[model samples]
Target: MFSFAISKSERNALFHRRETMATRMFLNGGVYSMADSGRLDARVEGLTIDPVDGRVLAVGPQCGPVAASDVLQLPAGAVIVPGLHDRHTHWLFALFANAVVLGGVKTLAEAAARIEAQLAEQATGWVVATGWNTGLLPAGLLTQSWLDSIVKGRKAIIFDQSFHGALISSTLAKEIVSKFPREAIGSYHDGVIHEQYVMLAMAWMELDDWTLKAALLQRQIIMGRVGFTRITDMGVMGFPLLHALQDIYRRGLMILPCDFAVQPWMLREDPLLSATSASVLHFQLRWLKEFADGAFGNRLACMCGHHRYSDGQGGKLLLDERRYVDDVLLARERGIDQFAIHCIGCAACEAASTAFGTVMQRLNGESSGCTFSFEHFETVHPKLIEHVARLQRAHVRIEVCSQPGFLSDLTDYTDRLAAHVMARINPYGDFRKEGLAWRAGTDGAITGDDPWGGMALAVNRGGEQTITVPEIMGTFIDAPLAVNGPATFLILDRDPFAHLEQLGQVQVLETWIEGRMVFHRRN
Candidate 1:
């Protein structure tokens, strides 16, 4: 249902066409467009928007002969900036995942109260929930017996903090094993189902089209509240969720745009893949994602030297080199040009880099117009950088999608490696110098998906590798509010550019997508 242009010529035609009737104009606001550090400049007076295409028709000082009917007069001294983009997040999952969220619950009693509340409300359905931090409930206490005592055999699944896996009650586990015949998912060691295998176990849980619509509505509501006009979801699973998104857009209920990665194995029957389409305005299914290693809390983060959970020789790779390479190359053959690999540990990072290098080599020394990103590149290593540099030399672009909020909320795995070692390993400054592109992501659903908060965390890291506000914002923002750009932007209460310390405190008074106001704070 999305109407985006794929080719450069098509976009050029859209941009070059003469402006149509300016249906709306945002008047009397300080327009602040961000650019690279070198160009921290420029201010505009207003923007005239074309309703038909949802793009800016005119810029500053182009005072209109248009009628006053379309004008939206700004409040005294309102500041209009570009709408925010969360380069990496799970906006869909943030709303649709578990009805009962247990994030930040440090005590078992608190978790029980929430579960019982959900039980009393739903009555008969499964108590599907996520956000069970290993630190919140240590491995020893995270057991079937422990959960059975609380839920009393009611169908319940308390997934990990990241929702990568789940700890199911015996009742639900039995039902899952009976339905899905997979050894990896069936064997619930310590009552924990690992990574992608949990997807197989989740076959028992199903939602109707109406529920998906409601979830989609909630997803947009939160996006507006958080000032995010665009989100890049890590991965989107199943055909129903995809169709639900399309149906929402068809009904004019979609307020923002989303670019998401897909798991081909999950979408094997999808006609969208069969069409081999790259993307439209709202949805992008060209990127394929895979997890090279499990999460750190699970002690399955493949690392070197010492790890508290896995074998001393370091953790293990969820997808070994050969399998990963085969899957990537196969997806590439099917027109998947973008690939996101989950690499939280140095050992996992190394393995992914090597496999990607093989992918490049298979292309006969060319990158083959493919992109590789390391999601949550938490612990970067010099050797990993060297591998990246080699790939870069061959024109293979590598992106690091980092979640700074992890530093604030999740610090349980910090002690596993020395501070100095990690500091020396994750040389972001050097990465920048070598022309490696990086972006800040909130890892939403895992952490709060606020760009301002993400900027604050990066600037306030209080370490040698700490980045400046300009450094982080440069990832998504650009200057001067280009005329042909989509009319997606935000309205803030004050001049966000000047106040560095108050970055975290800045509030989004309004959020607009394609010139239409989607979110207006009612303060």
Candidate 2:
């Protein structure tokens, strides 16, 4: 094989000068800098062709002709690849959002107990706690009495994990009555307030957007250290996006890569898109996030059949077909054509597919290459699978973001679900076998954001499938062009054997954006 080499001039020029060393220490009376203290770009001697971008870049070759600029040279044994992109994440909740989350508390008694303790702290005028799943909770109801007892005298409102519902105390209810018309608070009982009433109350309540962003940023930095380069902030909370952009500008820092899609209804009502600039846009797309149905775990997931527990019916559709169709059409007209729908059940998936097809037909194929993606394709039937495959054939990328962590929480529920239907849901292993691309999502509020776990869940077949390191990297590979994808070839540039020795689940050595280094192991 021909040896890859770099010119000597680049090496000397890239070496650090004395002053800017990250670490400099004297050993045996000689001072050696811990890092390339001066140069912005280190000179790498062993040039390897980058498979994805097709550039000759430096990588370390252990126990061989070593090059100083190669980033891998600093880490005793490691491999380098293009950055990892999450494609799906909800950073609005932050890390603490999932911790001590009172969302799943069963029974009004349990919820009341937790809230009563929280009320004692008297943190804020209106205490807000999230992470409640209605499907698993006892009685599966949010009543006024429950809210009042838990909140005591303080105004309180806790959002369901889905973000589609809210449980508010009587204090907040009184405030709601004062602000809106009597009709606005319709169907109001001491126990439950349904429909748009919750949202109306939240909108009226003053929320500190900046503080939420600050809280989210503090958590994002920790994610970066764990090797995450890009994350999708897939919710209506504009705080993370706003704060991330501001941070990048102020300090010339790049920690967490982000992509955000706003709610379509909000676009029509608030028009926040007009104020956003193109360069600052994450993922270079403005996807409209619409909900077709609720989540299965929460019993909010819409279904054609009856819900497992409820005799009346399954969950309701969060967005009516008319609303879904109108939003897609308006999103295209507004130049935000990318649509990301949250659909966990088959019924919901069909609605999303229908809406997307309708929008595409209406646009006469003038969508500027906009793609529609299904967020959590958790429960898909064979007919639906064929439908999605057909869409992909038509150049629409049908994507799936599954919460691997949910397997533990949902296994028993899934097994107890209709036997015929169980095969249709969370069948990622089958999807992979069919040559379909499966994108892993943290689904943050419900699952832990561990990419490795998601990767393992994607490839292995037995019990959700166990994934090898090579398989994990393949998820982001540009299929059709390369067998194992671009990153595979990139890995080949280094000492392949040694690199393999140091690989771990979800552990990344370096991160690059647009072919530039943004995060590297701090030797």
Candidate 3:
């Protein structure tokens, strides 16, 4: 069912042709051309590509003639679809794929054992680990003593699955408390790190550029293997990371096209913009990232009502209203086209909407070229939805970038917080009814970053607010392939439409970017 038509010699020949040939023809596949209306057009049998420029030159049965050497015939039953895009994801952090992953550990003891093993393997430095859920622990909390027992007073930080906070060893806490300002250290409770502390601790143990570049390349290959051709990095660190990505692109090592949203703090602290024309392959610095609140899983999301497990208290707001408004205005004035604000709770969503309103009113509603997005618009209160609809009616381009996989990830938690939170998490149907422009993201290493898993979650929604396959697919592949468009696409082993329920199980035979085969399944 999953096979490559090109043998080893043929694959080598094709790679050689990629450098020498001006044009290439990909034939014998079900090519789903994207329509202007954002729907898949009828499948074509062939596509002619200009390999040098990485664009689709022609399509349909009557594609112009090409030499036999230029034709790369696909295997039987191959299905070619337009490239996929994740509108919001942390690209740099996703590189932590190599870090000690502990997503499905059942107990704190299990987590400790895993951390102990990783610490044993590493010779020196902090032993960082991630993806431990307190809910899974018997004590229902990650205490410093527990981490200290395993880390043996060594510097370590174990991030929760939500990534809103972490569990730090006492050795790391003492170092932070001594060196950093009390405010910068944020909250350290029972061994858990919160807010600015998480950022500061990560900065302290930041990976070297060489290690980061290697991890980034691994992440890109993983993305291509999962059918992502373009991604919008929701919160990219400025300067060093930006420069590193530029170098990666210049060396022709970058696999996918990336658009970055610089952290708002970086915009203020560094205040430098790289030349966009330096290299077309370079990652584009696009938007400013502003966090309105934290995440729901960690009880840090700024909610209007009480958290079910907590002492009837709402979540925390991370931003000052006046500063948030001023920052948006400043970014717009500085020529940024978009501002992405992370708002997971109703209170945070309302606050961000209000800020957008204030800034738009000040600009006399002249926000045609600029847009604002509420990342993880998770909770849907009637008031928040109504307010967002009103803002949309007022010509404010307020889009939402939601992670449907959160539904699959938070199903049990949602049940526990049922009385306190909205019944439906990520109300895609409600968003559609309200005529809100929205896109889906995986949030990466934080959640499982598989797009097919995301698509499955969007369609099923665990029987709460389901959407049709096409509607869900739109969020993954928003645009259709066209002439002069970036040559990016996925070759699937089975037709997705015919195997809707098994979408996540569908194998990606190959992924092409800019007319070159970036990934191929090793049969």
Off by over 4 Å in 2: 1-77, 95-100, 103-117, 120-122, 133-137, 140-142, 161-164, 176-210, 238-255, 275-285, 294-317, 320-322, 397-400, 412-416, 458-472, 476-523
How far out, in Å, is residue 243 in model 1?
A: 3.4
Per-residue lDDT tens digits for candidate 1, residues 276-300, read 5545557666677877664423343
TM-score of 1: 0.84
Full-model lDDT for every candidate: 0.64, 0.50, 0.67
Give lDDT tens digits, candidate 2, residues 1-523: 2222334443223221122121111101111111232321232222232423533332332223323433233243333444455666765555233223675576766776777776776566567767666556632466666667656777777665545456677777777755544433123434344434554554454434444444555455545444455676565344334444444434333334466677654566555453244225333336778766543233425221112333332333455656676777776666775788777767767767787777667668575477778877776776777667666766675565655545544443553466556545567555655556666666665556655555444444345434444444544422211112222112112322234443325354444443333333442
Model 3, residue 324: distance off in Å is: 1.5
List the lowest-lDDT window of 10 residues for candidate 3.
Answer: 302-311
Tell me how far candidate 2 lies from the true structure as C-alpha RMSD in angstroms: 10.7
lDDT of 3 by residue, 1-523 (tens): 2221335564343222235465656555678766545555356777777777888877666367777777777777768887788887776674365568777777766787788789888767778787665555532445788778878878888776666577778888888755544433145556666655666566566556677676676677777778887888887654556666777776556747888786556555554553243224647777877765643233435221112233232333355656666666666655677878777777667666776666667668576778888888887686677677777788667787888777676643643455446455787777777666678899877666688887876776655467877777777883577877877777888877667788777778777777877777772
Candidate 1 total steric clashes = 1
Q: Could you give the candidate ranking by lDDT, starting with the highest?
A: 3, 1, 2
Candidate 3's C-alpha runs over 4 A off are 1-17, 20-24, 36-41, 138-141, 177-186, 238-240, 273-280, 294-317, 329-335, 364-366, 386-395, 412-416, 419-422, 462-464
The alpha-carbon deviation from the true structure for residue 153 of candidate 3, after best TM-score superposition, in angstroms, is 3.2
